[model samples]
Target: MARATMDVMSSAPGDQAETPTTSASEREPTPAELAAQQGVPARGASHYAKGTSANMMRSMLVIVGIGLALFLVTARPNSVTPESVDVASAAQYRGGQAGQPFAYAEGLPDGWVATSVRYARSKGDVMVWNAGYTTPDAQYVSVQQAVDPGQDWVDTQTNQGRVIGRIETDDGTRWVQRDREGKVQRSLVHVPDDRTELTTLVTGTGSWEQLEEFAEHLTPAKVTKAGSSPSVSTSPAS
Candidate 1:
């Protein structure tokens, strides 16, 4: 009975040791244990994730700031209407000396605004004195004097407008009227009787009567000494 008891004690200790080894093999390792096995710190991965999140947030904020700045710049106010301009003063300033042989409008209707003036050479090196205006009714009108421009220049100025009729002014000055169908403008061209190197062209959206009225006011001054052409000056007219 003593020998059987000793054998039973030895076997019981061996069974208990084997049971613990089986349990340890079946159990899964924790994340910390797995990281330790791979020689990496578990807390390092968490810190890296937090840093990535912070970087993403900073990028988003930068994009939003740029969008806000663009919105503020685009929403700023701007002026739309053109300002008033003086034609005669601008013409004189642009090489239209008194007593010079240059074409100018003498008596425009009240409230008519001159918007721009230019003294330059056109095609064929013909010097041109031009002025743009806005009528009281908000229509466009322009007076151009081409020095010795031929029929081609007239065609170019009128945009190849068809010859409609003639306008006889009060001063016995005859103007050839041209109409451009399917276009926004018409023109009145006057070539002096003496075939002088000066052709006056008034063209725009104004009616024939308005254009004739404008043409009647044209008075070409005789310049003793034609000065050098001046640079173009443009301004908005309302």
Candidate 2:
């Protein structure tokens, strides 16, 4: 029985271990295998191309938005206009009465609009009257009158201009012309033998001809009491 068992064991295969299997992480990948992987693109060229296309689209949208904003801002229209004023009525309300030693303008030409008028006590106890107007060409013109003012007052009014020449009006009144940088000033002094002296100045950004026209229309008047209400009898030019 022992001999039969030994013959059967010898006939069987020799005792050898099977080969061990390798894990996925420990194995190397081929180039074709990597190329077939999903969710990943090729390096450099394709990736930069997609990124550049997206950036260009965003930049174009921003440029279009800025252009639209500028057009809206510049094309808007103005909806309101400024109100006009009456100089004569304003002067009357500010103590311009008959027989007062003040200066005023009458028979102003067409297209001239008075914007302001004032009468106030100034330095050296002198009374000053001023009336501002907008000329036909939209330039600024003003008539300033002072009672017994100093030469310094005249200098200040003329912007320290030097006397250029003299102009004689139709009424035999002589006006002194002063040349200042960016302005023209014409002044006249009235010294009555029985009354106080008066100085009238026509100064403005208007042309010399416009200033002369303003000076020609000026007339001397007197201030009445304060708080006087006067009627305006003039109309604006068409």
Candidate 3:
């Protein structure tokens, strides 16, 4: 029998004049049946699904991040910044004393020093003698501090530090300094027995080639013994 001439059936319809329609019971399925009927959704319904997938994912990530952050915050117990050191100039900070402290070198441009602070580091041979120079304008810091704000070499490097490569001038003198973010300003000195060394870390701003001219002037000196004091001066810059 042809389908056009028979009653509705899963298979081909047999020869019958009547076509069957689904009953209300069949049309309105049970909850399980309805669920099954909607199981593998149609492509159209899938797009409009009310799901919180994105929000759930974001929440999961935030939880995980909070867990990790908590661990990090609790693991160590110290300030990230360096300690406030007393100014210890080379002349004032002596190696031998009742309670000896570390000594640091202080370099100031002429007419830059308001008063020389003679103090000792609580720790090493390194001395830090801060020159109490007034800020030119209403500024509360040195021009260098305004221009280049660095607590020290390690602080600068450890913090938002920059790497300025070797810059050698035309003359024999070279200037090594920690740049402002990555610009040049100060002179860093390293000394050996027979020679003096200079290192300039310019952060990401400078290229090795850009500092090459300044690097040519530096003469690397080996580390000298602690007892002897060497003169700190600039040679003829290259």
Candidate 4:
């Protein structure tokens, strides 16, 4: 009986020593716990951050596009009018200085704005009077009065256009219409009277009808003589 008891005690001790036991800290961690320990963001948080960045970029692009559109709309060429210049005074003053009858535009309706005026000598030493205007429809037209201009001067002023046809105005003067293909239009007239030796040219990108209208408004201008308070005469071209 003592030997059986000793064997039982020895077996019980051996079983206790051989059996394995696990603690909470020694077990393998779950996926979620591993991710947390590795500092990985959650799926929901990652998606939210990406969505916010994309939305911000889209909003910035939309704002920039809207600003560009507004700028283009406000800066259109047709919406702006050029500053108006005084043709009558310039014609009178230049005519007085040059001792000639300079022509000026008169009785024009609203929206006809004179843009430029100058009196200068050409390449052939010919004195010329120039005036430019913008029509109501935003078309450009200019008048050049030169004393005995040569063919080269005419070609230069008319942009090397060829004579298309002739047109007679209310007065006895006749004008030739010249055009360059896809370029400019010109109306040219010669005043070879005993008193005046002038060649008048109307040129621009405007239509023929608009050019004719501008030519009809040209009026002969008289100037005050140098050092004399002489009176000037004004006449209509119609």
lDDT of 2 by residue, 1-238 (tens): 8666555555335754333356787788765567668545545454435768787888789999999999888866432222456665555555444235555677888878776666666667767777778787887788877655877887877788787778877777778888775644444433234335566778877887888888888765545665566655343221
Sliding window of 10 residues with minimal summed lDDT for model 3: 138-147
Q: Please give the CA lDDT of all the candidate structures.
A: 0.72, 0.66, 0.35, 0.75
Cand. 1 Cα-lDDT: 0.72
lDDT of 4 by residue, 1-238 (tens): 8666555556454365332346789999877778899998434554535668788888789999999999999889757777677677778777878877788678887988888887877768888888888888887788888777777888887878888888877776678888876765655655465425678888887789888887888897777665454333322211
Highest TM-score model number: 4
What ranges in model 1 sit over 4 Å off? Answer: 1-81, 90-100, 221-238
lDDT per residue (tens digit) for residues 29-129 in model 1: 98888989999877554453566878888878999999999988886643233355555555555544533355557778786766666767777776777
Q: For each candidate in turn, give its C-alpha RMSD to the true structure in angstroms.
A: 17.4, 17.8, 19.5, 17.2
Task: Rank by lDDT, highest first.
Answer: 4, 1, 2, 3
lDDT of 3: 0.35
Better of 2 and 3 by TM-score: 2
TM-score quality measure for candidate 4: 0.66
TM-score of each: 0.57, 0.57, 0.25, 0.66
Candidate 4 local distance difference test against the native: 0.75
Number of colliding residue pairs in model 4: 0
Instruction: Choose the strongest candidate by lDDT.
Output: 4
What total of clashing residue pairs does each candidate reach?
A: 4, 4, 30, 0
- Expressed as tens digits, the lDDT of each residue in 145-238 for candidate 3 is 1112223543443233344543345654443444454433333332222322112221222233433322342222222344454433211101
What stretches of model 2 exceed 4 Å from their correct place?
Answer: 1-82, 93-101, 123-125, 182-195, 221-238
lDDT of 3 at 48: 25
